[model samples]
Target: MKTLKCPLCGNELTSIFRMTKTGSLKNKYGCLICGWETFELRKNENLAWKDAKEFISKFPPIMRSHQGDNLKLDFEDDVLTLIGKDTSRGKLYLQNCDGDVEIATPEDVEQWPWELEQKGGSNDI
Candidate 1:
């Protein structure tokens, strides 16, 4: 994978597939530190992206992992917000998920974005 550095803050950039209001998925590159991002609009051909609020509601409001960790799910500005029950764990912001955010889908939800996973994690949720 290629490394993406933020030109403004020298921080690593994160890439995610964001659903546009026009019903398209765009590959977005953004910096958690400086809030710098690139506006990239692309056409989604295969996956039928759903609304953030609607998709999140499919799962239970609270989810528990096999390791006994718990997270509360919420939606904001088309992003999936995962708030850890433990205060020290920090929040995880997700742009996409597999199926529903439930116990059965723990494996998929654990697979966070590559860049964020590398640098510990981001609390910019």
Candidate 2:
């Protein structure tokens, strides 16, 4: 997987898991250097940029590691199309926007989008 850096700290972020929730798609994200956990969900094309920018900026870059330790990436807004990476195994790790982190295999990467809908991770907050 490609090295993903935190937009706030510019430090490498680590992928913890691909969060899946009901009514939404799976979200990719990581722990921030500080400690804050960040994640984003899928959104329509029109709301993608606006929601993305708003969502990304709302959370502070994390003043302290304890407060902000992680950032989650999303594909709903086409985040995966830009920063998502295929690990060649069976999953995909992605991070983008303000900042997020994840490591996944090729298979996971390929089906992440579909899995999102199947799992209904669109309702994540």
Candidate 3:
């Protein structure tokens, strides 16, 4: 059998299989270096290879963080922002005067509880 190589990083690819809750088998192809993944249910090796090849050709490569990487945080006044790595999205946190906290997105910040906003706390970090 020919070894599969990751399209984005040229690293050797690995195959993983799992049993679904419905008792069906699921097959996945993954790259440890680039964190690329594709799923298919073909039982035949040839079909699985075809699906993997198609997915690799069509899927975009995404940056991934290595193990043990630390994420940076930004604080502005009363708001805090968490910087995400790889394909993760950043998150914003809002804190109130009574020490209560709530998570919100940038677009939803304005719609957050008026009292929280009045506390002069905003996080775009």
Candidate 4:
């Protein structure tokens, strides 16, 4: 295992268990040094071009077709945030997950811009 700095005390982090809708999830070494625990999902490592294109049409030309393995995404800005380490069992996702905040559905999240995938609306840039 790798050692990580604690966001609380700036000391080494430790292993800990956290309860979630999908039972238990792994963390980037819980913080026992200062008791400041983080329950955020890391960026998506890979996302297929098709999946991205399905969401946004302004994707790169090479992305016109499904390429790559997966797309690393911002959980906070995810249209659906599934919280699970594996594909088996169940998949928990957040509809409108935002930076450090989110909800189970898009309607539940009260934020602007909805997401990057959506454009041409009154909230457009």
Candidate 5:
């Protein structure tokens, strides 16, 4: 099984179980670091897996430890392609339209995009 991650904050998601009123345990996933929680679903249920996978799929891999500025990466044809943008060659460039080009480091490549669609403004990058 693949590890689950929080879609908003990119943290490791932990599984939790709660007893429902019907006396059945429902499984849920939550991020301890960000307090992101998944909807309750019964164990051994396919929908639980589907919900977790689908929720995590919305956000791509982001630089979880970087504290610097979140560079605005460009999206291309429904894909977030950050390599060689703003007429930059050989390295990744920030697409902030500031005219002055800023080259991103290997670690910066994982930084979350500033323009990404977020829910509840939960992106703390």
Candidate 6:
């Protein structure tokens, strides 16, 4: 079986069983780290597998670790710029023409456009 990951946070997932009120077991894949639960069940294993695959294909890999106060990123075009950082609060300040915005960490910047440019082709974002 292929491994599944949480669609929202990109964390590892585990298969689990829960008892419904009807006293039947329903199998689901859940992410312990982010508390994401899949609604699809093993009762329809094929459909559940398809849904899981579709979910995983939608998100970027979660490569963000706690960089603490040391996180830094520099891009040449000023498309994204770091304006402030508060490691104690786990917040980062960024600014672009869209205006200033706060983020949880540097990894939150997925840079989808830059990635597409690097690949020399369009990709699903």
Global lDDT scores for all candidate models: 0.38, 0.38, 0.47, 0.32, 0.52, 0.52
Lowest-sum lDDT 10-residue window in model 6: 63-72
- The candidate 3 region of ten consecutive residues with least summed lDDT is 61-70
Off by more than 4 A, model 2:
18-25, 36-38, 42-125
Q: Model 2, range 17-104, lDDT digits (tens) per residue?
A: 4435555444344446665334444333333333433444454322111122222333334434324332233334455455655553
Worst 10-residue lDDT window, candidate 1: 45-54
Model 1 Cα lDDT, one tens digit per residue, 2-103 = 344454444666665777788766765567888865554335311212222122224332221112223333322222334223213332333224523432
TM-scores across all candidates? 0.31, 0.24, 0.38, 0.25, 0.45, 0.41
Write down the RMSD of all candidates, one decimal each: 16.3, 16.9, 16.3, 18.2, 11.6, 9.6
- Model 6 lDDT tens row, 1-125: 54454655547577767778888877777789988777767665556566665666655332222221122234424445455555556566665657755454545654423232323334332
Better of 3 and 6 by lDDT: 6
- Overall local distance difference test of candidate 1: 0.38
Instruction: Please provide, for model 3 over 1-125, each residue's C-alpha lDDT reduced to its tens digit, 9 standing for 90 to 100.
Output: 44455766657677767688888876777788888766666655566666766665453322221122122223333433223223345344444445555554443433222113332333211
lDDT of 1 at 100: 36
Error of 5 at 38 (Å): 1.3
Q: Could you tell me the TM-score of candidate 3?
A: 0.38
- The lDDT of model 3 is 0.47
Model 5 spans with C-alpha error above 4 angstroms: 60-125
**What TM-score would you give candidate 4 relative to the actual structure?**
0.25
Better of 4 and 5 by TM-score: 5
Q: After TM-score superposition, what is the CA distance of residue 57 in candidate 2 from its true location, in Å?
A: 13
lDDT of 5 by residue, 81-101 (tens): 343432223245443434454
**Number of residue pairs clashing in candidate 6, backbone atoms closer than 3 angstroms, sequence gap of 3 or more or interchain:** 0
